[model samples]
Target: MERYFKRKTQPEILEPSPKSPKNNESSSKQTCVDSMEINSETLQYDPGLCTPILSYHPNVRDQVRRAYLQNKPCQPKTHAFPYTNFGTKPRRFNPAWFTQFPNWLEYSTSQDAAYCLCCYLFKPDIGDQSGGDTFVGVGFKNWKCKKKLEIHVGRPNSSHNSAWRNCEALLNQKQHIETVISKQTDQDRIDYRTRLGASVGVSRILLQQGLPFRGHDESENSLNQGNFLEILRWLRHSNEGIKAVTLENAPENLKLTSPDIQNDISSSISYEIISAITSDINDSLFSILVDESRDKSSKEQMAIVLRFVDKGHVIERFVGIEHVVDTKASSLKLAIDDFFSRHGLSISKLHGQGYDGVSNMQALVAVAKKNSEIGDLFTMVSSVVNIVVASSKRRDILREKHTHVVLEALENNELSSGQGFGDHKRFIAGIAKEGSRYCECNELGQYMQRMRESGWESLFDEVSSFCDKNRIKIPSMDDSFTSGERPNRKAHPITNVHRYRVDLFTDVIDKQLTELNDRFTEKNTKLLLCVACLSPINSFFAFDKEKLMRLAQFYPSDFSEHDLELLKEQLENYIWDMTSNSEFVDLKGISDLAQKMVGTKKDHTYPLVYLLLTLALILPVATASVERVFSAMNIVKNTLRNRMGDLWMNDCLVAYIEKDIFNSIEDEAIMQWFQNMKTRRGQLF
Candidate 1:
């Protein structure tokens, strides 16, 4: 590991408290208390001390009344003698003072002097703070009253306010403490770099340790690995630079010397993200979807999606792309399987599969067959449904009626001789001819033309699913050999790789579907299968297939329409009519092999499923859905283009989808469980 460390430093002591032992400690002192006694040292006579001494004097009603009757001015009590000295010599009549004592004390401007009158009138008694009494109800459900408690406190004054004001300084103290902590950490990191003999920041940590900055890249930063390029990026968004604590705002990339290195960093980041995401997909069965489209440069790209089983299927996320050699099922399957192997996933775990084209449909069904629960395939039931329902949703009443007719026919036991005879043929022919005419419309016309395939789409999906359940294949590679050794190696359709590609190209995109570019992300060639993909053109496949193939991966034989050539000829023909003659169809797809880019090279035709997928990718649905994903990526890895290693970015990207898992998690409970984690090792933690 590249060593990096930081040290912690202790904080400094603060200035001492302001409390003092002596009142006259300061040279500029104001008030000094000497004595209240009637002696030469008496301070009441002094201007400063007289007011306070008078303020503390007790009230004498008789003396005040006597003074009032005598019409005497207010004066100090020096002349008045106590009874022992002179007061008992028959001069005790003092009823005039109370009548002469005027109104309350006046407000004064002086800060130091106090009004004796106001002090007597307003001074609060310390013992008077408690309230008189508090009442409490008593006795079980009865209404008896009882005195319970009393509480009282005086409001804040000058002395109390001094203590309360200390809070104003706390923020500064907290900031200082934080700064000290940060400095200590930086120091430790510096020490770590010195020990490791590596550079630190723009300046070397070793240099701070009294060693010279002595690396070749120390001078030329293309070689320098410290806070260089990061600084440049910071400069790009100048204000955010100082505040950004995120890895994105690091300044090293800013100073990095070369563009190629910058690009390498970028690519490295994306790769790391993709790698991390792929790894998460390895643990369980997942659905796969794919779309095919060509770039402006005419490169064929396969956008893949892996629908993972998170906490809930409704919130499941998709997006796992691979550039394959061709549109052939084998090549597409190879790309998918290779990716799975890279991510450490097993093919045996694959359960469900979906596709927009015939290639993906076949491949996914094949993979589903590997699962015991899938019973040798995902029944073609759903594919058949999507075709009809999707067509039905478009307000195609006759097609909907036809679907119900089949359901109705199945409800009734019959030979189903609904074709061939002239009377019946005329009835069917009129419907077929009517559909052919409706196919001329801009929208539902094409769907009308391939009504049968659209109807079969749902059937193929459902049937395959039914078979995959309770059935599975025994792969050839397993050491256990309980059965006969007469192996059928050629059973895999992938064996004829070239033929698969040719077949796919011919069937898929023979019509208007090839126009599915730059429309939407799900529709986009680069991101079609991504969650944000969208397009104006329709599509037919989204892949869900196993990456690896093994022999004996089957139960007792089950035969469907596919085993015989009759079904293939019928479907292939319908697919051709639907695509080749549709409006907005590309003619170059028909004549030029160069225009048909496949995995590694160009081709003229592909399998029926590819045709279906080509249609699906070009479909106008869910373009915005895929945009949401790429939008997240753009937000995550934007133009300041802060780079994350593939693993970390993948974690972030997947986090958007992992929301379902997170939602189901009782985080508070988990946190409570982990609250003691730090104490697990008795201080090591």
Candidate 2:
């Protein structure tokens, strides 16, 4: 105890002096006095300043504990017993008995009583049981009942034994409460992640298939648990790893399959798919196709599609569906611009446009003058149809004449009796729409080739000989004919039937030749000719080096002096290799050439060439694919799902329309994506 004392200043002691009272004359009075004095080192009751064995602070209490453990309990000297007038004997504390239980038997000189040190420091609040009050509070001063100290420490499960166990644990220090709690938190985080993973896995499947995620009744007794929960339960049932760690096993509030959780997972999957599309587009030139329609609630939504070439394959992805207040062209253009800005796309990439109910070339009579051959043929056809079917009387005469001609031919065995022709008036009326029946550009191309091969003289001879054999009169060029009658004057007429013949025939041939010339503008034709030189078809006989160099001049913005020089060298090498290489022989078109370039690693070597090819391929000639998107929308967002949100609708359309790419995505990859999105309570994959 002395070795543990390290106070800076020595403690001072004081003794009260005794004095006789002035009125007192009794010197023979017997005074009750204490014979044994108490020491200051052992009597203070304040836990912070006194013997630190009782301190709650480990630093101070542990030091005192070690000092006390080094020595036995102290027992001071005592004097003769002070007798009380009560019938009981005053039992003074005995010092010799301290040797029997040296570690617990302690004497407090100030109290003139003995106490158990072990029980004083570690005694639990068991009230008066097991002599708790006797050993610690009003110290046990019963010297005659020395066996009471031994009785207090009774059997193996006694309070004293429990106190001793606490004392032992306090000194060990390894099993702290904080350390156990920290380990528990770590395990909780792991379990939360596992639970979240399982929830995300179930959500991705539902989103991918465009399936409904909820049910009308999702109670525990219901057999159908909805897509989200039922699938989660099935995952738990199939996998032993998460069976005991998810769903019902998880905390109520953290089941991880809540509606909010499902939506969050859906957003994550949609984000990943959008990210993939963005990566594929990656600054490439793209075209936009926009179409508008009224939803179930009559909200006008503009569905936008991106058409671009990705690795030589033409791909169109649904980027977003925006709600527009009106369907004006300017309003639509603004909406398109805003959508493009939101998705990090540039408006300059747009190359073509289409509308559902728009007619740009509506006046075919006006457009016919652009090509004289088409104009002449149109004028003749219009005149003939008007003259033959202008009135009911003329129509009846033409019908009767045709019937007589057919009967005569049938009687001579020159025509089949079962031959029939439908009414011509209805056919002319049905060709009302612009570019409806007569605008076949491929057919025009074929007709131009025939005229060039057979010459105009041969065509005229065939028509003239047919009319002569049918005994139809040919109008003489010198005959006169009335053109029209004026309101107040006689109509003027002209006679040159041969002049009309020469003019009509020559006009048809000249216009056919002009169409071939007017097919593409100078710059466009040069570009097309250059592009054609890269085509792998026509037996690869179209690859010309001169035209390709001319094509480079059109894009002065992209091609520089150095680029042109490099392109020339590369083109020569490319054409030489393509003509001789057996692998190139199988490619039949520019599309196949572009695809082969990617597969054969030529795209990396000839990047610019591949880029040009991709641009040409992606340049939209029609909006047919965009129209298909609207058609898909009609099916997906029908009356039943009319109230679906814009974001949800876009997600469903992306999954439904681009199913080919969606199907290629792995389920495990989607599951992992959901797991990494946020912290949860269970594992998925």
Candidate 3:
């Protein structure tokens, strides 16, 4: 009996050589391939179809045995058992035998015979008892031999009884050594999870609020042991079960309140958020917006944002912030390449790119400086601002004088009092004027052209009125203008009017008009016109079927000829549907229209039109998402936290800027990921 229970010596499994033939006779010699192929899903349940138990690889033999045991024995009691002629007498299997030996009796309909379930799975190779092979391999169909069944269940220590005992022990998992040991380890894992969850919760709160995690002194005796530790302590006190297993009560090595642990938790959370964003993108067409800025430590940091349409709604996600050695184009390209590779993204899918508009303005200003008069005017205005703000006393005096002027204006009713009454009101009024004037790109270009042709007189008059009110002398229009730098007598003379109106004012306006023409070329102007046709304001008043069809032609790669034909029809129906639907009546912009289309499921109804809308939304309008990341970087890596590493700063910034994504993640997920990052002193799962 003891020998039957001894462990068997099995051959080592080896990998099959690649050079081996698929139909080679030696293929049977490879055990690893066979064992890898066997699993619960592939296990045979029909008793007659099962292979010999010892023929299987020893490594997976137990798995196969458990599968068979879990499924129990296959008993086809309803089967019509056939009989063989024995001494001129015909007989068949009796269903009453199943009741007599309920645990081990199994009938295979394929062979029309009876078999033992335990002996098939646990029968030994060395010791052979009478009729053992008959029950295991050859079917026992002797209907005349009623006493053989009792002989098979012979003495208590017989081969059949021993195999039955082994089957029982295998089925009762509570008696296994590993299960008994895991009882204690399971408690340890529960406690570890509780402790780690508390730590992650604290980290999330600090990350969301953009607060620093560490203090000047983190010693236990100190009053402030940093936000991470102090917040964790407060959480511990709030819950009794957590208090009993966290902080001072936890194992010193597994407290998970160290700065490194906090960083790991924060990084895991950021990666999870980025993973979700990429998943939402799902390898579809997307646009990237990039911007770079210097942190408080003077390190050049580049931020990236991904813009894509998801489920008929436009989404912009802040993906990462990388520390580059320089802000040159080449360095930025390399940084972007690395970011794309790490996030499983491809530049081929990028349909658009966005950068700071300040670069274009800076180039325009540089070009405008070519005129000496215009250059001198800009220098004067810049110098004034610099001089006033450079001195604290001067800034205070300027503020006081501005306050007195505003008060006098208010007393005289020159300024109105109400909500948004001062600078905000003026800003809104200016925007209203511009909005009314420049309804489209072509209009803006024409407006600039008109400004160049006739705007100088009004500008000059306003300047003269300001000078007279301040009691400053206005130079005569006929007086000869001279350079301020020690008058060059060799140069040609010019009147004050030409200097102020032509050299300075006219040149400035002409440069602006040239920039406008350069930016809004004929092709770009046409594209903008097509895009404006989809505006949802006032019940999509700008809707134009022909213009939208032209827009579809621009993206030939996305819309085929067949798609275009379908889109034309979709557009005709779409306009009618949107104009009649109250859900889209008061939409403010394209973005609102997009969301409403999704809410009403119109995107699915008019998929081709929705595709055009999605493509329109993918166009990069601004790099504001990237700019927000830089703003978050300043707060996360301020002077006090200047020493924070690049990776740490990036992690904190991602969590802070995309708090919406960060908040959606569960603490258990973050804790599980952190645990798997490295081998810990305690198990988490």
Candidate 4:
């Protein structure tokens, strides 16, 4: 064992001074190594001060490699290299050598030698092809051997060439393994967002138009793969980027075009719209207008609308539809309760309840039916209309006769023409302008009363002239009248003048007056008159503080005694401000005034007054919104799509009825909402 140890010790001892000149070179190399320090930060750019690449700690090696590559080779082209003695001549580093090996050539000031930048950073540990570290470790001091630089580079497979390639790869981060993986992940996320966005955009359009999303056959070979898919294909074809990543181009699992996916996107969009509306409501008092109708599926669907003040403007939004087992009051109440609970609404916030106009019209029709003469007149008129409409020949003959009469009247100058025609059109347009219903009712009643009292002779004259022109015989007013019955001898007789004037003309007018009076009762008319007092027309000329206060008294729950007192004072200030301010001038209607008040921030100034305005606005003028919702239901849940689920149909109706709200919402918002609903196959972020 001692001899084995002695053999290893003897080689180490003999290695020190075997070659005297080589020993001296080794001492200088050792001294050079001792003078250098390797650090990642404050890296030594000078090649002479940099430690050998192989001597660096493994972890620090990469850091040094990157630092050296970034600083590049220290060529020192302008530096004056000191002269050194060769065999028989003086030699020194040449600046022109840098041009020959521009990338790898590096000059060190301390050692007065050249180095290889690429080899120093990445040269392998052991290989004959690696070109012994003359340029890397000891540095190249033999200026006479200028061709050694080319020799160090060697062949394509040489270590130095490999090191150079590695340096290039390090500089280009895109080629790094981590970067490649990250880019793939980022691209997938972007494609997912784009695909989802396209799907949402198509859904929004279909929902707005109340168009069906799916077709009967949706196979790949089918010509029509539903509205959702066909519209998506069209959109993809229109856009290059979208075309590259959606539908057929998308991944099998992440296409986002499945039926389930379309429903999810639609539900999300509906949720966002409801969220926006509720956010606008912000727990403010609101009235509910509900109406029930049977869908094509025969399901009793109840549509609910929210009428409230949003930003001081009266807004009526169709919040949702509910399916009830029956249309009974209890069933409807339960359905409404469930819907409100789900949507975070409180029943206490409901200020009023309104149903569709169908009930009122039915009541009026029933009243008319009770009157024998009125009932018979309506039946005969309806019969005539049906007869005229049911037969094509009769309709054609009627159209031709009417056209002939109109043409004859025009030629005879009995009808208005030219400027007179324009005046008549203006008169009709004026009647169409929006006005208080109560005011219109009163005006109509007064107009009818005037026509009844004094306009009969003019009507009689016109009738006589029309009969004469048409070559029909006219009965004399003084002649006896007889019923055209089977037994004419037994019929009661009356004068023609009394029969036509009293029985026909006066009877019809009196029935119309009674119906009008019954429809607009004294109490209801007074309430409407009070409501109209708040109208912002004629610079609020209709504004009456006492009348508005009286209107407030009608809703005692909304306004307390203290509120009424405050409202009285506020109303005085409100009317003065409205009449004087130019912003309130020329306001088209109550809605316009509400918007203007909110725009001018006056709603914040007079809280009580604004509250009154909201209350007035919330009163359902007509069940137009509810009627429109049921109309949309007929279109969305038609015979073809009658099998749609209740929840799905409601979502479609909400989107279809509130198109303005749907349009205002962004696709990105809807996409984010869908993403957060649950863990999806593809990330939308």
Instruction: Name model 4 segments beyond 4 Å from true.
Output: 1-186, 358-366, 369-377, 380-402, 409-481, 486-523, 536-543, 575-596, 599-605
Model 1 per-residue lDDT tens digits across residues 1-685: 2367453222111111132111122211323322221111111221111222122223322222221112122222111211222333433212232233322111111111112221222223333222211100010111111111101112455221222232222222233343445443554433322211111121122111222212234343455533443443344454443324323332342222343223222223233334344556544445455666543333444554555532211112444434355789888875665454334344444433444433422443444354443442235656656666776465487677767766775677432646337668697655433322111122232453354245444644565565564375423322433225466666433332233222332233232222222122331332223211111123212211210000001211211335323324533553444345344243222111112323312112333323222322222222223334444545544444343333233334443433443334332322222211111111101
Q: Estimate each model's TM-score.
A: 0.23, 0.47, 0.68, 0.63
* Deviating ranges (above 4 Å) for candidate 2: 1-184, 217-226, 233-249, 294-296, 346-530, 544-547, 604-607, 660-685
Candidate order (TM-score): 3, 4, 2, 1
Q: Which should have the higher lDDT, number 1 or number 4?
A: 4
The candidate with the higher TM-score, 1 or 3, is 3
- Cα lDDT of candidate 1 equals 0.31
For model 2, residues 136-242, the per-residue Cα lDDT tens digits are: 65666667777888898889788878876765654443344533444446566667667766776676576656677776678999999787778888888888767
Candidates 1 and 3: which is better by lDDT? 3
lDDT of 3 by residue, 253-318 (tens): 778888778877887888788877877887567888888899999988888888898876678899
- In candidate 1, stretches whose alpha carbon ends up further than 4 angstroms from where it belongs are 1-254, 275-282, 315-320, 357-685
lDDT against the true structure, each candidate: 0.31, 0.59, 0.74, 0.74
- For model 3, the local distance difference test gives 0.74
